[model samples]
Target chain A: MQATESVIYNRAGQRVVSPEYLLFEAPRTKHFMTGSEAVKEAVRRASVDASVSYPITPQSEAAHLIGELWVEGYVGVYFRGESEFGVMSEIAGCAMAGARTITTTSGPGTLRAFENFPMWAGTRIPVQLVLMARGVNSPLSIQPDNLEVGFLLDTGCMIWYAENAQDLFDMILAGFVVAEQPDVHVPVITVVDGFFVSHTREAIMLPPDDIALPPYNPYRAPMPVIDAEVPPGRFLRDPFVMKSNYISYATHASWQWEVRSAIERSRPYAKRYLKGLIEEFGDPSAELVFVACGTAAAQAKEAVRLLEDEGIKARVVKLKTIRPFPVEELKGAVKNAKYIFVPEFNVVGWLEREVRRYLYGHSDAEVIGSPRVAGGMTMPAEVIVQEVLKLTGKEVKHVL
Target chain B: MMRKRVNIRMPALGGQGAVTAAHIIATAADYEGYYAVSNPFFGAEKRMAPAESYARIGLEPIFDRGEVVYPDVIMVFHPQVITMGKSYTMPFYSGIKRKGLIIINTEEDLLTDEDKERLESLDVKVLNFPATKLAIDIAGTELSTNMAMIGALFGAIGCVGLDAIEEGIKSRFLKKFVASGGTASLDSALERKFKKKLELIEKNLNTAKGAYDLAQRWAGEQGLEPFLPPPPKKVTV
Candidate 1:
């Protein structure tokens, strides 16, 4: 069966269109566009309340597209911030006003926004941020890599990866849904590989304008709405007051615990909203399973196909929804496999590290991962097929 | 029981419009109602660097992404791509499938006699089409040679209809022309090419058709059979 693009379909296998933009024509079922263009279209359909952003390569096109839509009055709030730090700050304020704000950044921009990453969870604000993955900072090459994503892993936010432009369109909608839930009010990071996905053009079947995603509905009335007289959460007790009473210390400590637990509770919501954390193909009982996320996942799928013709069977378990880690889903998919081969484009190999952390249950299935495709090197199916041949104790000289 | 998916890899130098040529082919196939995925793989340098773009055309939704390593067809945009090589420094023939077709856009074949004999022994079909020469002859400027290459690809592959490619070329170029209001768009067209709006379109179309005819004639002379869809099998139920 063909891998389908429609996320929501009916019994007849036809896409179930939502009754929104019955008049708009932008989301024509299948339009050949770049991933950046698709994200722009998705954001227009999302009807965001605000998008305060600092321009950066790979991601700037998306931000610009959304800005154009906003300027033409198809979208809601839009702003140009001086820096990534200011952009994140705007997101926090707009989100507090119950605005469905969104933004995107890459490479050095991610570093600029580092301080505000944890603050999104601290304030329980659910902002949808797209990290078009890039190597964070110095040497200043504008190529695709996931090093920036590695830094944000511990920043108290839910993360997801998109394999292509179509997935980029779908993930944004799903991300907002999970982030806005009453029980899970943490922000979501929907990542796409810079240049690889952003610049590449392909056909993406977006929901028709009328059937576009519904606007984000915040969990409750936002704090400190002067119009409604709703009060913001009090910060009356200082840390010095904690010296006066242990109970006060516990109350302040609960804030940190609440954010962590909130993200943990978002796991089921992620599975529900974003479908399974993985999209698996090939044989589960094969000697090896190619585990990957983002652009590498797409490359792995192609490699698996090449290997199949050579009488070497393999499975592909693509990590889609990246956090709350998706350990169980990956564990289940790679259960019968003896090895997991992960290829990433960052020197850190964070994707492989994350896999090893979760693949502990399957003691027999060893995780073999490396920064196989790093820098500006686009990972080819030949490289992956070569890796699989090495594992089977076959001659690596020329077979693959 | 799935139809074969075709992977085509094209390598070109910077500023050669190689990436655009790849897009045209993929877009033409897509316009013909097939699923086509195209992407360009380039390094940090903007110009004068060797680059490669790829395309995967199939009847099904193609989940595959990145460069087409195991290419069914290899189209070299310039003979220099073989001579100059890539920025990351990899050989051109590193991932080409055996017994596949190689179409290079040059007047004379770049392959040495030994390499030609070696490739022939492997059943690989290698052809040299004077794409840029035809473009300069038909379109006055060599800039639209990419269009000529697309025409040659359609005539050579025959997987996608030549009519679809012609239509694809028109729609892609006409996007800006139509968007800015037809002949009133002549300012930029004239500024860039010293040609009127309609004249620019006419030249590109003629150049593409000219290349297509030459490539089709070569294919016919070589006794190469055009790709045809398989007949539907009877269902047992």
Candidate 2:
């Protein structure tokens, strides 16, 4: 992909925004902050209009930190909704009202907010969602279960994962840019592991002061005006819209079709931002490439380093974007590689399923190692090392 | 002196502020130009439940977010964790690496004959301090024991500097002073525990100094190695 100049704009579609929407580069500061804290500050840097809060562990620190920022006058609007369902509904309403809204949730909460996922997409309202990955009450467990992620794969929203706090900050920043695009408006679910990324502390560079993306400017060209600019006696939607026997079915089906095509059309924009988000590490020509995102990729980097010492040449395909899945780039990166190893934190290997779909027929699916250790369990580099050694018919030795 | 990368595991009670100490240690490591990953293994248990927090400081980004199965240093914030067998996996020095460091919060020898024998077999270095007593005597409360332990850790590993830890403390506590103007929230109980916010943080720092001085003096007498950079690997090829 050819690199484009970092051109900033004030108006997207017919909507006019503040002049500051254009490029405003400022100095960034490096801070030792947890992934959750970094994300909270990212939300502040973005100048989000309003964000709902329904605190759960791992993700609670993020909500709490954002609340602190809000109290200190750094954030615009922060509130704890009645529940996850209420929080999603409130964000939906806020987004429709041209509010740059966001919210964070985990396993069970994601399920509770299920009814509103389609609502946000069907209406084409772009709201940033911070999903701290967790198991969804799988056998009454409260650890990192990631079926919440797989369950959302078919949902109309775009998805991205952060490998570390650095990626966490950049991904969310770009997530807003990609989601709020006039032609491809859709909510983006940004994921981080429950405890791994959410709770762990690391070095993060924050955006400089006076630098932020423009606020959400809804394009009201085709939709009804959300502002108070409608004519005093202008006729709105027909009272009995569904009773229009003929066009009702066509209108409903077309709306759903548009939601999907918008995501397809979003491929270019997603690819543009994702190019900056994705990092490919390890030997490109090796027999196996460990494909992972979020914390799993963090460990994969270390595991690849160790494997190199043992003469087992391998590489890592660190995936950042999953929804507008990086099919083309990922295919190219692993073309010479023989096997794909996907270490998932979720019980259901959603990431592996994605790998198989894009690399179908070309790559055998079974070599995609799905040695899952779920339920708040973290797969250490040693675990991956032992498994890889076992798969290569070598005597497995514990490196840790 | 520096080390390639080191894992320090601190096991304490849920309400003992070990997790915060772990974060400060990581922050200190960051200030010292190293990568650090600090995380707490918390379950559904409430206050007084055994909590294990870990910090891995290294040259590169530390990624394995798993239990420190082979910790180079283990600091026990509470003595009962060993006596009561409260640890989840690393029960005391069970997984200490060879020539590792073990710092306990008790002055009196609390380890069993079996524990001492195991330590001798592993050739691990041990540093003991009455951290709770030091906190009570200096800070007028036992809550600063974690700070005391932090001081002793500095004395032993010397991987990070004292000024870094001080800066880490300031960044963490100063925010609380500002946040106090807002609504009463998660830490209101602790806020109520301290009559004044200044007293709470000041005493904690003073307690950290007390432990640091004690460990520095005590470690010298034991002939322990000062904090130094790791020697390069000797290749046999």
lDDT by residue (B1-237, candidate 2, tens digit) is 245578888888888888899888887777766777787774565688888888888866577665676688999888888878778764567778777888888878888788888988888877777899998999988888888888889877765667777876766676643443555656776566555666777888788877787787777887777544632332110
Candidate 1 residue-wise lDDT at B13: 71
Q: Which 10 consecutive residues of model 2 chain A have the lowest summed lDDT? A: A10-19
Candidate 1, residue A332: lDDT: 77
Model 1 TM-score, all chains together: 0.84
Q: Native-vs-model 1 lDDT?
A: 0.74
* Model 1 misplaced stretches (Cα beyond 4 Å): A1-28, A218-229, A232-252, A394-400, B1-3, B44-49, B82-91, B109-118, B174-199, B227-237
Compared with the true structure, the alpha-carbon lDDT of candidate 2 equals 0.75
- Say what the RMSD of model 1 is: 6.4
Question: DockQ: which candidate is best?
Answer: 2
The parts of candidate 2 lying over 4 Å away from their true place are A1-25, A72-75, A220-222, A228-244, A248-253, A364-366, A397-399, B1-3, B176-195, B221-223, B226-237
Candidate 1, residues B1-115: lDDT per residue as tens digits?
3336778888877777878777777777787877778878734446767777888787666766666767878888787877666523355655556667788888776777777
